[model samples]
Target: MKTVGLALAVTLLATVHVVAGDTRFERSLRNLDPSARLEQICDYTAMLRIRASTPFRPDRAVGSASSPAKAASNMLVANGAAFRSRKKWYRLSYTCKTTPDRMKVLAFDYKTGPEIPEEKWNTYGLWR
Candidate 1:
């Protein structure tokens, strides 16, 4: 019984690790085209502040019957970033996909503004 319990615990931990791994996410971000609009505001050369939220259900697929089906365990969410401007700070959101193999950004919209009080921008050390 003890051996069975130990095996189950190890299996559970391995499952959790596989589900949470996100190695490809940053890799995708690094592969973004330099001329892309996203590059204009956020300086990838400098350190960035990223805040990832809880995993959420991704939107259901539309008309593409030929595409591979996504697993129910795969989760997606929008992650926040704090970046430095000339002398100011700004925020943007990057859409990310979390799968057993890796996590990567699917697509991201344009950067936003100076950020608000509730955003806790200072926590990211953007003010410096």
Candidate 2:
């Protein structure tokens, strides 16, 4: 009985950790209004762009599909890419699967404010 209880406890803990790790992205989106627009800015091919905007806010972030996990917290701005907005800025991470023309932006996250930098971004797949 003791072993069974311990095993069950461990299983529950692991499940919670996985669920928690996945929630950041969902939480970020939850703050947006239903009308917010999520756009596919660029096609795949190691480079891709996605934009999400809300009338209440005008900030956004764009990153490659292979962009690292730390991208979530750091707010990294890709080289040669311009981040535009007068309001707060957001972070967007993506995963490309094919050529630039055939590729597609997979996932991303958004928040208000400038990027934190490569080091500060969370390594978790919050935007994956």
Candidate 3:
């Protein structure tokens, strides 16, 4: 019974994680350049993880803000990223690591910064 319970728990955990990629996210990668694909995967992770972990609902995320992110070899360290939530842009930075094919996000670590001032949005290429 203990073995069965453990197996069941593992199965449920797997199901929840796998369900995140059951959509067209993986399929869409076939059409993008390698670098673009990596960005897409990491951006998707940003939106999904933030929504799941925070009260904010992020619809978009840009990896570049005040400065361009450092992306290389399946890893992206975005120190000046931004995420749009509830029509407001917030400062965001994240380190996202992905698989070789850039189809799966292996890990994502992120921090949300203070709200970007409305007057300064133009400087960062942020929208209203």
RMSD of each: 15.9, 14.3, 5.2
- Tens digits of per-residue lDDT, candidate 2, 95-122, equal 3222222222344333333443444333
lDDT of each: 0.36, 0.36, 0.88
lDDT of 1 by residue, 82-121 (tens): 4443444444443333333333323333334343353454
Number of the top-ranking candidate, with lDDT as the measure: 3
Q: Model 1: runs farther than 4 Å from truth?
A: 1-76, 98-100, 115-121
What's the best-to-worst order under lDDT?
Answer: 3, 1, 2
lDDT of 3 by residue, 81-113 (tens): 999999899999999999998888899999988
Model 1 collision count = 1
**Poorly placed runs, candidate 2 (over 4 Å):** 30-128
**C-alpha lDDT of candidate 2 relative to the true structure:** 0.36
Q: Which candidate model has the greater TM-score, 2 or 3?
A: 3
Worst 10 residues of 1 by lDDT: 56-65
